[model samples]
Target: MTSIQEKIIALKHKKNALILAHFYQTMDIQEIADHVGDSFELARRAQTATQPVIVLCGVRFMAESAKILNPTKTVLLPAADAGCAMADMITPEDVKRLRAEHPDAAVMCYVNSSAGVKAECDICCTSSSAVQIAKSLQEQRIIFVPDQNLGAYVASQVPEKEFIFFHGFCPIHHQVKPRDVMEAKNAHPEALVLVHPECTIDVLEMADFVGSTAAILDYVQNSPKNEFIIGTEMGIVERIKQTIPQKSVYLLSTKMVCYDMKKTRIEDVLKCLEQDIHEIDLPEAEMKGAYKSLERMVSVR
Candidate 1:
């Protein structure tokens, strides 16, 4: 019998598929994947791929974006319910309401959101590129929807730009109190701290480095310190462990796992690859509208 890894490779060959996995996916899945990175990088890679099948072993919005970018290609999510709470924080109706209130403001949807929300957006951005994309816009006012923490971080960086903030955040990160930082510091006296910018300002302030999942990995792999405390999801910790087996890694807190992301497992990935179930779909009109926003984001940097 073929192992899951062998099955994944064989299935890829049979389907002419490209697996664009998120850094948070299982190590085995990441190892077998054609590419692994954060949402924007994965989407960028998926957009440029010649493969007819895109197996997105990540959250729902990510698979949706793959389909949005490559409409003709078949995009499959390992688990249909692997949703994002931050993304769910806002909806198309929410955008419409916001737009109604600020008629002249451009709406910048985080790529973590749904296609329906993307359809209503002027552009989309990932954590790494949000500031660059927002700053590039000449608009006097921008509605940065669905991620209040991310919006706040971008706003702080670009004081020149005006932003209308949303009241949403990642619950996992939201749970990370300022006290947690002090506690982690107290416990790991020698460990350098790295955090996601999605974290609250208090956490961001204490971080030795701030970046996306891929950037976090790069930081650890290249860092002089062999010991570190990570402030993101446990999947990141797993990635660091696999890539830098020589390093001693620790989580800032045990409270950071995203249950939504964890919903998709290696078994689910192999099953999806085998059966091609839970295919992602988007309307041509919706795709066209969402594509403009996504394309605009890519053109930013």
Candidate 2:
């Protein structure tokens, strides 16, 4: 191992720290991560953490989620500037405005949103559980926040509910066009198309499978198919190569790279461990209230 990596490992042992990484993290960071998954997985991991410290190797909102679940534990984010456009686009005010306009409808937030926004939500759902969570809610009408594409996808699945969407999206995923899928399909006819629902409906329609980053990984792992076109972040391609080396995986859109996810490098993680930089802290009320929606999501399934 490199000297720096060894130092990082030694410090982790000394501090009893847990590393929670998103699927979109770089390969080296993922290599050292104790738990590697999406936002929901990281939050779930944080909730059960016995460790006193948590190092989140993802975006800001993800670290915030970790802090929400592990309030007492020290949560540090490697990259302080790693922010998601979709998550940062909306605020608690927007949630209030929507609620004011649609007083009867319930608020369903994607985990990609800010913790403060989640505090005002009726329930929280990730891309993997959004369909089920939305379906599980008792309200006839729901206001889905942040990623409108994902909300529309969930609405398509559960026809019984009416959805009011907020105008926000993952800029990386938003770059991918339906034509991109068609082109990828044309180029790799033998490969199956697997896409995240964050993509536009047209793009998703062309996909052979539509799910979250974790679901995408699980799908490729279990599928009998050999070659596949993955439509999520490029880091997932790194994960696929590492875990399922036998399978051939290709990125559906070259534009799928999330700059924020790439912002945290190995050096940043080491620095975070060394100096405890960029610690995430949310107020007790917000953290506790935000967790209720997350809890409801867990309970529904």
Candidate 3:
């Protein structure tokens, strides 16, 4: 470890802080994180944290989620400006409007949304739990928000329900076209294609596997196949290369990078711990509202 990393560890211990990172974070940040996982996993970790201070090494929405889960704790976002484009694509007003139009439908907000949006929804879900959550809902009509791609994927899995999708999407994942997958496949014909459900339905249809970042990692680690094309973010590809070196892993597209997730450096984490900067604070009402949706998500089996 570098001197900076050692310093971060020392400061974390001094401050009684727990560092949580998303799977899309840089390897350096992940190395020092007490827990590294996808959104759902990190939220669960945040909820169960024993420490008073929590440093989240991902985008703003992730830090917000941590704060919502652990309202009493100090949740610090290392990169204050690191925001999710998809989260900003929709608003509480939009959710209200959708709910009015589909009164019979239950609102299911993706975790990739603002706390305000979550407060307005009936329940929240992450990519990994979306299908199960949707299936578990009592309402036959579901109004899924933020990322239409993920909503569509969940809808496909639970065909018994009717889904009303929003126009929002992950700009990075939405950029992947079917031709891009075909090109990658042609270059590595023997490689099995693994993609995130955040991709468009057409792209996901071409994938041999569709899962969250953690699920993708687990699949690659356990699968008997030796060669794979990872879809999702470039960080996952780097992680795969580092952890599963024996497997020949390739990125499905070079354009799969999430700029927001890449904003936090190891140095930023050190500064966050030292100064406790970029603390996440939400209105009490919003926190309580979002908590209901998120708590419901966690309670799902």
TM-score of each: 0.96, 0.98, 0.99
Number of the top TM-score candidate: 3
Clash tally for model 1: 0
- Model 3 TM-score (2 dp): 0.99
What's the best-to-worst order under TM-score?
3, 2, 1
**Candidate 2 TM-score to native:** 0.98
- What lDDT score goes with residue 28 in model 3? 91
lDDT of 3 at 237: 88
Q: After superposition, how far is residue 38 of candidate 2 from its true place, in Å?
A: 1.2
Q: How do the residues 102-182 of candidate 2 rate in per-residue lDDT, one tens digit apiece?
A: 999999999998889999999999998999888788899999998999998999999999999999998988889988988
Residue 98 lDDT, candidate 1, scale 0-100:
96
List all candidate RMSDs to the true structure.
1.5, 1.0, 0.6
Q: In terms of lDDT, which candidate is stronger, 2 or 3?
A: 3
Clash pairs (backbone) in predicted model 1: none
Which has the better TM-score: candidate 1, or candidate 2? Answer: 2
Residue-level lDDT of model 1, residues 1-301, one tens digit each, is: 3387888898899989898888877677788888989988998998998998899989999998998888889899999999999988888899999999999898998898989899999999998999888888889799998889888888888899789988989998878987898898899899899988789988888889888888888898998898898989888899888878999888888999888888888888889888989899887888998999998898887
True lDDT of residue 62, candidate 3? 88
